[model samples]
Target: MAFTLNVNGTDMEVDAAPETPLLWALRDHLRLTGTKFGCGIAQCGACTVDIDGVATRSCQFPVEAAEGVKITTIEGLGAEGEHVLQKVWTEMNVPQCGYCQSGMVMAAAALLKDIPEPSDADIDLYVDNICRCGTYPRVRQAIHRAAELLKA
Candidate 1:
């Protein structure tokens, strides 16, 4: 099936099966590789993307369901080194292997949008993405720092 997806503020056409996961469509068809494929079951959060402002697991989200929704991958977050989260992630050294950072950033972006000043508990509750390097503390710190930067 040919699906038209609004990705990163651009309308992209991809030919994929209706049940094909949006992760593959974005990476294979649209060539938006920022959204990674961690766990195909949507448990890892490595394929997180923003669909209409909500952080969604793209690995299991069907491409047919993604049509007409505004999708934002890590590539769409901002220009290189411009997004507050990106800067904070770098400044705070948020990633160890960097494999899960994109999804973590996407999840964090959604949380910050909904809660500008997130508490530790809120961070724990919201950004559920897993990092094998156990960078949760730094991720939280970077999120707080990003919030501060956004506030300034």
Candidate 2:
């Protein structure tokens, strides 16, 4: 099964089953390993990727379902890691272990794109990726800082 996918502005071919999780196709077939697989179920956000501008869990999403959609993994966030959110994440030192940072950044990016100056409540509601490292405070701060950077 060869599926031609539009990922990060490029059309690439992936040989995988229709029901194969999009995470495996991205990581194994496409070699885009930035999207991590924390849990096979969608409980953890480590496998998040942007599907048509929405943060989608790649772990459960099927390859066929993602066909023809614009898929953006952490590697696609910006060219050479220059996205505003990435910059803010670095400056704020948002990650402790850095395991969940990719998903955190993707979720935050989606949230900020929708709501530029998100309130703390909005942050609490939108950014739901779990981090055992307890980096929630820094994640929130980084989102705020990214918002500020966007405004400038």
Candidate 3:
């Protein structure tokens, strides 16, 4: 079947089964490689994306469910790569191996949207994506830094 998804505010048609994971449609068909695949199951959170501004796991989500839905990947997180969170992430050195950074950033972006000034507790509750490189400390730091950047 052909699923037309509104990704990053662009409409693109992809041919895939309804059961095909949204991750595959985004990466394989749409060639949006920023969304990574860790474990096929949703536990790893490496295939995170924003569905209507909410951080969603693309690996477990079906392509059909994404039809006409607004989606955003790490590549489109910032227009022209100027997102303050990305800058904060780089300044804080949040990534070790860089494999899970995209997902972490995506989740953090959603969190910041909901809570402009997130507390440690808010981060602890919302930013639950696993980072195998153990960059939680830096991730937390970058989140706070991003919040600070927004305040300025």
Candidate 4:
């Protein structure tokens, strides 16, 4: 099947099966590899992306389901590397192996977009993505830092 995907403010037409996961289309067809593939199942957030401004697990989301929806990957999140969350992530050193940072960043970006000043509990409850390097503390700190940066 062929579907048009609005990715990072660009319209891209890709030929793929209806059941093909959005992750594959983005990585394979669109050549957008920023969205990682940690777990094929949706349990892990490594394949997280923004669909209509909502953080979604792309691994389980069918490609056809994303048709006509605006999708944003880590590559498109920041402009000139100035996104508050990206700046904070860099300042806080949020990645260890760097495998899960994309998804973590995506989830954090969504959380901060909705709640500019999120509490620790809010982060805990909302950012459920896993980081194997035990970088949760840093991730939490980065979220707060990004929030502060946004406020400034």
Q: lDDT tens digits, residues 1-152, model 4?
A: 89999999999999999999999999999999999998899978999999998899999999999997999999899746577888888877888898998898899888988898999998997789988898999999999888887898
Alpha-carbon RMSD, each predicted model: 0.7, 0.8, 1.0, 1.0
Model 3: how far residue 106 lies from native, Å? 0.4
Q: Give Cα distance to truth, residue 54, candidate 4, Å.
A: 0.9
* lDDT tens digits, residue span 1-152, model 3: 99889998899999999999999999999899999999989987899999998999999999999986799999899855578888888777788999988888999999999999999999988888888889898999999989988988
Most TM-score-accurate candidate: 1
For model 1, residues 65-125, the per-residue Cα lDDT tens digits are 9999999999999758689999999988889999999999999999999999999998988
lDDT by residue (tens digit), candidate 2, 60-102: 9999998879999899998577999999888878889999889
Question: Which ranges in model 4 have alpha carbons more than 4 Å from their true place?
Answer: none
Alpha-carbon local distance difference test for all models = 0.93, 0.90, 0.90, 0.91
Candidate of highest lDDT: 1
Q: Candidate 3: global Cα-lDDT?
A: 0.90
TM-score of every model versus the real structure: 0.98, 0.97, 0.96, 0.97
Runs in model 1 lying further than 4 Å from the true structure: none
Model 2: residues >4 Å from true position, as ranges? none
Query: Which ranges in model 3 have alpha carbons more than 4 Å from their true place?
Result: none
Q: What shift in Å separates residue 117 of candidate 4 from its native position after superposition?
A: 0.5
